[model samples]
Target: MAASRKVAVASVCLVLSLILLQFYVTSLHKELRAKILRAQITTFMSGLISLACWYLYRRLLAENHTVLACPSRLLWTLWKSVVICFLLCAQVTYATNLFFITTDPQWIAMVCYICLGTLIQLVCCLLVCDLIEIGLRVLRRGRQYQQNQISLKAQQTRTVVAILIALMLSARGLTVGLSPPPLKKVTIPMTKLPRSFDGLTVIQLSDIHLGPTVGRSRLQDVVDRAMATKPDVIVIAGDLVDSVVKKLGEAAEPLKQLQAPYGVYFITGNHEYYTGDVDAWFDKLRSLNVQVLHNEKAILQNHKQPEDTICLAGVDDNTADSFGYDGHGEHLDKALGSCDPDQPIILLAHKPSCAKRALQSKYNVNLVLSGHTHGGQLFPMIIAAYLVNPYYVGLYRVSDHAHVYVSPGTFYWGIPMRVFTSMEITHITLQATW
Candidate 1:
């Protein structure tokens, strides 16, 4: 908790520095000078609203004593609340007037795209502007032309160029964020993979995050794309929805269409426990005929050659135990205990950090699939994601016998933007090296 708070404080300081940088850059223009005060007020109000939302969310979590009483769960809730509140405040600040006009989700989303997109553009442009200024300083070192002084025309030109760069990048980011996740084909050669199970294709969809911005239409499109692949098995590693069943269940109805030769399986992501109704989501997915794996295993066999079989095991999110939910905790032992040691094992965990533990376990787990990092989801932020996750995205060969694949995500969450990262539907094929 203390560490999280310190990180939060550092983030606040960085944001303040960025705001100050924004003011300094804008002051160079006479027209923008007048708008600085207004911008400052907007930022202040946004901060206040974010604080209020954070407090309320924390209080709400506290009220849910059964789920969030634990220190770890509270800490997670608080951190999530901070992020959600910050984004909400950004949207509200950016679309202040639009909220009065209509409560439509589309309009709100449009406002979010425009506002957040513009903010991202502005931040990038400012950074570029600073870099240009620094380079000019370096070039002019020891020269007689007043140091730290740049002509208005030069500044304006630099700003214009930065704006152009920002526009291009933001446009690409929004396009990628809004588009259907592309299918990413990956083949993992397993030394112990059974001959019959060779060439087994599994489609992985993780972090779909169906909520206000991403809904039924988007989900349907993803489902259609996955079906087109004709995979042998389909797996939703975790984070399928961001909201409760009552809110996004209809949007998730497309899951019923996901069928494969083996089956469609799901495991809990941290977001599931955050929804405060993990069991409800389990029931909902089960109703859709999606096998919900809770620290359990399912034996996949080639009906034609019943002896050619493998174990497919899935565990709950790493943080599930912290949420104090009964029958919900990541238990690799329980999931893999009954599996035949000789047969290859494929484990599905939501977070990549679990890959290390799975590999170190007694079982000869051949492959592990996960997706929680979202490939960092945004620029600069991806750096943080990389630092935290052992495996950020894509395939990693942990050992000669084991491999791990981390998908960026099926879709994004919050802000409706994906800067340097992309959404993906991972299609993995298992090949027998033996």
Candidate 2:
């Protein structure tokens, strides 16, 4: 109970930083940058040192240095993370226009004085970061995590990923910064689908945020899991690659290795829109024999009879702010226009929030597949997902018109630890209830 209160307090303080930063930006923009940057640098250094300590501590456990990895080390790590909490508060406050520096906290005076004070603060912060880090470890990992024998090498690899991401983002919130991009597999139920193909499984892997973070090894693991199911069709939900396909082009080889009786297909995620050319990824997936389904469309046919079909629809990410749309990325009703409404339809939507409209439009799409959440890749963020996507994770019957399944995802994005959650390679055996 006491610990819960502390976490709650920390969370509240963290949120307050945002409110404060909003004020700082609108009013004290000039004086705020230096103070904030100083805070950031101090936080960054603490994070680095804490990361190093944690690396050593975890590696020690891996090497049977459990005894040598004393409570003291844990204490240091905890202290650092706590300082991280405070800095996160300040940083968010500044980033979001919440800070209101005293009108007299002048740049000329504060810059010089703050520079010297920052130096002193830096030294003190370093010590505090170390102590806080150690204390956090003792309280969190050392205390609660009684059994800790896992892969040291994997832990190290993930740890390095964590540190690099932290440095890149200056995020000390430390709930595992970002999650691996989600894998969306289009599961089309073949049973009773005029296809006469019963229990046909389609392994859908989508939004594979393949970037500096998502590498070949993890992706190959995804392919292996997908293939393990012996899918009849493999449908990529969309946003197959978040950034340049270059980092994951070689990784695409594994995707090419994917085998299904039917075939593999891909669509687009909004990330592809913002970060990479969505059309090019479509071409890339096509080169690998994975059909790219844009607003146009495709029909999933059983090999035995081409006439037997499951109408499949794919669209650009559906967000209220998407550019292609007059407002919402691309409307499914228009995207799926010209479809045979009588036949069952499966739509690949990147953001699950579009479910309400899909139903409202009378598209009558029976099953919708989506995977933007990655079950909050971090942790509490899952709650945020609930704000936009009520079907945050797993299968849910939102209404008579739709059954939506949100894959928790196979790989993680920024930070690899899936605290309270497990990565899923959802082999949804699309079934006809009747």
Candidate 3:
């Protein structure tokens, strides 16, 4: 009952938000406003249908009705038919775009600027409008208490301010989203780190969602930046690409240029499993000279002092098992079991939450590199990201002997709007605490 109530409350909030968005569109140009309204309506209907299907499934499960003896049988059949039609239409639309559309870099950039930029701007505008309205109400109340009329000039000024603020934020977000990620240098002092391995620089790149928008040029820029750092090791924590190997293989070609004295390593992220071609991606990455770490460890030793070594272990994304991919699951034990307990270990996990799990386990992990949150990727959403992840972004000291560094991401995903957060190529230098 509590769960049901929470769902009901969430549904109500979603409906109200859509209504507000609909009302907000009235202030937009006619053609754009009409298109946005249509999109919103379609989205709302799809969500409603999905929710109804889930509710019906739950009801049927609770009743243990294996046979179609219930009155909802007919309704269930109708819903299934509608869902199938929707799926078919969606597949056809996607295929049409994929085959017919030319994903030129300039074209993708323009689309992102027009669609994603506008959407973000509208949301910012709505928020600013609401704040202005509240301020006006407060001012009006105070004026009324003093027996004074609210001036039209004051309201007009507030409106203009709101517009300017929204525009500035939107512009900044677009610039940040489109630009190459900046370099972030971090020094981590480890008590157990071998002196021979001191000053070991590792370049960490994560969440480089190469797809239609993030093409070869963008990836090349990232590769150049990482190489410029002159890193001893290069590690991609997770979420390397959004599309399948066939679609993004060319875009990811720049990765082969990455060179380090140690190696370039990669681990699976949740997105890899979602692509349903995890093995294919792994093979592609391996072909690019990237060592795909599947719940495994690599012992790194200094040539001068072979005895002074550190363990670099990587586990699969925590949610990999849920995708039903055979032999793909996060096994921290498998990753760290063979490592020498006396040596400092750096664990690579896609999600920051895994840092806590590693610390709790018997493994003596000195640091964990991850990047799944994308630092919320946008404003307001960052707040929710903080609530969900153990470490939202930046460096975190989880324990006396352990630290976690969560990169914002190498590239923006989906909407391509990054506000109050930046994409980064994290350069970490290991310092001996002796």
Q: lDDT for model 3, please.
A: 0.74
- lDDT per residue for candidate 3 within 277-317, as digits (tens), equals 67888899899999988999998888899888889999999
- Which structure is stronger by lDDT: 2 or 3? 3
Model 2 Cα lDDT, one tens digit per residue, 147-237: 2443333344444444344333223222232333333444443323563656777676655666434556667777876776687877777
Worst ten in a row by lDDT for model 2: 95-104
When 1 and 3 are scored with lDDT, the better candidate is: 1
C-alpha positional error of residue 299 in candidate 2 after TM-score superposition, expressed in Å: 1.1
How would you encode candidate 1's per-residue C-alpha lDDT over 289-354 as one tens digit per residue?
999989999999997899888899998997656544566688999999999998889999999988
Residue 407 alpha-carbon offset, candidate 1, angstroms: 0.8
The prediction achieving the highest TM-score against the true structure is 1
Clashes of 1: 0
- Give each model's whole-structure lDDT: 0.76, 0.56, 0.74
Worst 10 residues of 1 by lDDT: 96-105
Model 3 quality (TM-score): 0.73
State every prediction's TM-score relative to the real structure: 0.74, 0.57, 0.73
